[model samples]
Target: MRKISRGGARQGPGWFARRWTAFWMRFSGPGPVGKLASRLAAWLAPPHMDQISLAYLNRRGYIDATATIYHSDLRLGQNVYLGPGVLVVETKGGGPISLGDRAEIHMHVLFETGRGGYMEIGPETGIHPGCQLKAYVKPIIIGRGVMIAANVALYSYDHGLAPDISICDQPLVAKGPITIQDDAWIGTGAVILSGVTIGEGAVVGAGAVVTKDIPAGGIAAGNPARIIKYRNELKNADKINE
Candidate 1:
């Protein structure tokens, strides 16, 4: 076994060791005991390339076998969970990535930051499976206790569409950061474009393409995400009818 210094220089396992670990991870087995064993192996065995401290593991933070994290400045809070097939990767000129305590990133989610971009996921937030958060030109900040459903895509930058330039060669531009305030709920398949702020306690309906800001306690739906109603309005309506 290769000696891994806790909080030391980031050095991953050799090709052979990585291959063996991948092979070993395949037999995670079928029941509760098997699941427990697999989680333990994922937390203990394989040599990680990032600066994930052993103390985080001891605090019950779980990173699944298939997850890939490649951030230069990575910080993990207590009991954070990175589920299977999750990828935290940097593209070009990437910046810091931090996850607050008890943040859960579910299966198959791709979190990418590049071009001097940064990202911070707050505590008690749960990002469901198949979500893609691509940050560039600005940071993607997800506040505490937020719930983001499956297939939600949030992009913090847009490409410059000059007529002469090929779309592939276009430069990335952004109005500002993508901020999701505390306790917001983003529905499945929603696409949150650059510079939009989803305010605290707001709810975005499924399949909505948000291009503008959604105010706090607002209920937004449809393409371009119109603010359908405020949550407080619903409560008031109920009281008036009674």
Candidate 2:
């Protein structure tokens, strides 16, 4: 028996050569030489189970090779994709987290569920890189076709501030669930708080802290996000002037 060190000359060179030969042989037309090369490659390195082939991967979702998923109840629909470096976890025996069909979670995203909390992402939703969704005591529901830009944060609970208690020691509280309705667009670095509903077809400006509910078809911005304009209203006004 022989021991092989990590990234050693023997292993590295041999591994690369085998892979290159395998690729060349596989691409070449079927023949005795190709068959022999393919068999050798198979013996050297067997194919690992991919997203479509693995039952666990399919059940949870199409997770990237580099993604980290912790022990949690996850229900994912067909064609859901999780990019590299994504993290999904459930702490304190929380409820199941679900993602609908064709949901795409990009690189470095995180989904965390706290005690008795759950999170749901609707069909065709695309979450960009570095986004986080934390459900501490309530649900965080994102509706269909929602586009969440990079560095967004959605929190379904807030830390309570009591006079006698430290911030860290205080319990987390939530007035209600955080909901982002269908076809909404959340700009980069937006922070959505608990009890807030970003209505259907609404637009949230970049770096906005949403603390209140936005009306349907509204455009909101700034801290404690206020409705700067209504989409339908603006359209109607433009039509009248024209």
The best candidate by TM-score is 1
Instruction: Give stretches of model 2 more than 4 Å off.
Output: 1-61, 234-242
Best by the lDDT measure: 1
**Model 1 lDDT tens row, 1-242:** 76667544334455444444344344443235444545555553534323133214434466665677776677888767777788888887988888999888888899999996899999989999899999899999999999999999999999999999999999999989999999999999999999899999999999999999999999999998999999888865467557
Name the runs in model 1 displaced over 4 angstroms.
1-57, 236-242
Model 2, residue 82: distance off in Å is: 0.3
TM-score of 2: 0.73
What do the candidate models score in CA lDDT, each in turn?
0.80, 0.78
Provide TM-scores for the models. 0.75, 0.73
User: What TM-score should be assigned to candidate 1?
Assistant: 0.75
Compute the lDDT for candidate 1: 0.80
